[model samples]
Target: MGWLSMPLSSMHPHSTPKAYLDAQLTYERVIDEPAEAEGEGGPLPSRKGLRVIASSCLRNKVYYAAVAPTTDGVDGPVFAVVCLVRWNPRAKDGYVFAYKDMDETAGPNEAECPERILALLSPTENHSALQWRRRCIRNLARPTAKLEDGMRIRFASPIKFTDGYEGQEFFVRKRGRKTALAISEHGSARYRVTNMARMAFSVVPQTKVHRTVF
Candidate 1:
């Protein structure tokens, strides 16, 4: 997590792959909403200055990385967007990536930025490299154990997410040789059970899952 000199404009829709723009926009809008008050710390601050520089969708969750200037409206060393309520806003389901350093920077004297997220802001790496890596891993992965309806699997672990899954274990609703569908009580999203590339996300009845994962 060193100096990332890439201009923020590089993340705009015209500059990013069309496949990613919509999800990034959605995440940006989600973070822009006023934070809900939960407890002692009260509500988190509004992030009007935070700019999402990269995003990728993996199964049911979408991950994003963002940056903000250290000082109010000026430039220089920046803070990374790491303290998000990691869940589907509409569903109110919670997924936790418990980082002790929720907000950190790359500059000296500041807490070190989380390297996994910081990689999304790397200048040497191609913008879409992480997305491509995830696609490849998802497509090639084979279940080491045969799956059956009602069997619970920690499938999210094999993908090597920077932050490991911190929610209920996924129970198989249905399974096939190549892909399967998982369900959690709090969230049920539309999914394409046959194909990974055509996965979709929409709030569905808790009993229905329209998408699948390999």
Candidate 2:
């Protein structure tokens, strides 16, 4: 963790990404219908703030993040779409990313943030430049582990995330060398994964998830 004073924008007046990044590490969540009482389905989720995961921005466009599709939303594998966006009368799925603006669709979040992380380094040290480069490399590299159907992996990081859960994992359904489709019985939405997010993951039996999820 380091202090980085990025160019001040009315968009992000703060000088460091750590404050926002750290806030995303954990979040309060609300899923499904906006009800105030328990019913036949289950307990109702609160209107409190949600834990933001990944984010990216396109000019003034902004976005929050989410993990899964709501019970009434569409289902399937997709890279992303505004229809999957959330946190308002707009996003019917769930409150994932909170977009500040729109480009005929949704806004962006941290996914597109530049790699120039302002780490704490001495301006006078030549080695500092090398160290920063190395850290960025490690942050951007894709996961090397192989993925196949039926395997489980944790959502470590995403190269391109349209939909995701911050503190959840998924079971692989379909996969490629650099990407895979994953499903979750818990709080996770069925989202795609890139090699970067596949790092340092854990495996769980499908049956175990089934028995425990309910």
Candidate 3:
């Protein structure tokens, strides 16, 4: 009956409000430069055009923000923040309307959109984002017989890279019942990992698989 009471299918990418919150916390940035500052520079991760902070609420509230750099003026810094509320209790598709303006025809406050974008330029969030990225990179592989291309497989035991760096996972280039051709994340080398029948592969989260920005 309540937003939080919605079924799991309602939050497709997340299983619980905590999971959704983690996704938000793991995706936002707070920048040091003014909203007007040009040319981008920040940790590769957590860099986006929008910084989002979300809280669990009956309507599943989320705050989308853009921040401006501190200034010599009394205003200090500016924030262009927009709030969005989930209107549907059974779907993930309609949760995108800008808060109070849930009407499909009503757009967000155009005046503040630019200011909010400034906050997304920060890279401080990357420290935690990268950690989460690596952690989420893993998932239990299906049966070795079901291995597919692009799947990063991890061995039951750890393995070392040629340059002395150690890694336990490799991208599956070619799958086989007994063995598979795989490549490393570094892409500098190709090697064979045996005992496929006993191995598990890692998968990137669907939300991140196609991410081109922070």
Ten residues in a row with the worst lDDT in model 2?
76-85
TM-score for all models, in order of appearance: 0.27, 0.32, 0.23
User: Between the candidate structures 1 and 3, which one is better when assessed by TM-score?
Assistant: 1
Task: Name the regions of candidate 3 deviating beyond 4 angstroms.
Answer: 1-145, 161-165, 175-189, 200-214
The sequence of per-residue lDDT tens digits that candidate 2 reaches over residues 11-98 is: 1533223333334333444556655567675665534342323333322222222222223233222112111122222224433233
- Candidate number achieving the greatest lDDT relative to the actual structure: 3
Q: After superposition on all CA atoms, how large is the RMSD of candidate 2?
A: 22.2
Task: Name the weakest run of 10 consecutive residues (lDDT summed) in model 1.
Answer: 92-101
Of 1 and 3, which scores higher on lDDT?
Answer: 3
- Write the number of the candidate with greater lDDT, choosing between 2 and 3: 3
Give the residue spans of candidate 2 off by over 4 A. Answer: 1-126, 138-143, 156-167, 175-178, 185-189, 205-214
Q: TM-score for model 1?
A: 0.27
**Alpha carbon lDDT of each predicted model:** 0.35, 0.36, 0.39
Best by TM-score: 2
Instruction: Give the local distance difference test score of model 2.
Output: 0.36
> What is every candidate's alpha-carbon RMSD to the true fold?
17.7, 22.2, 20.9
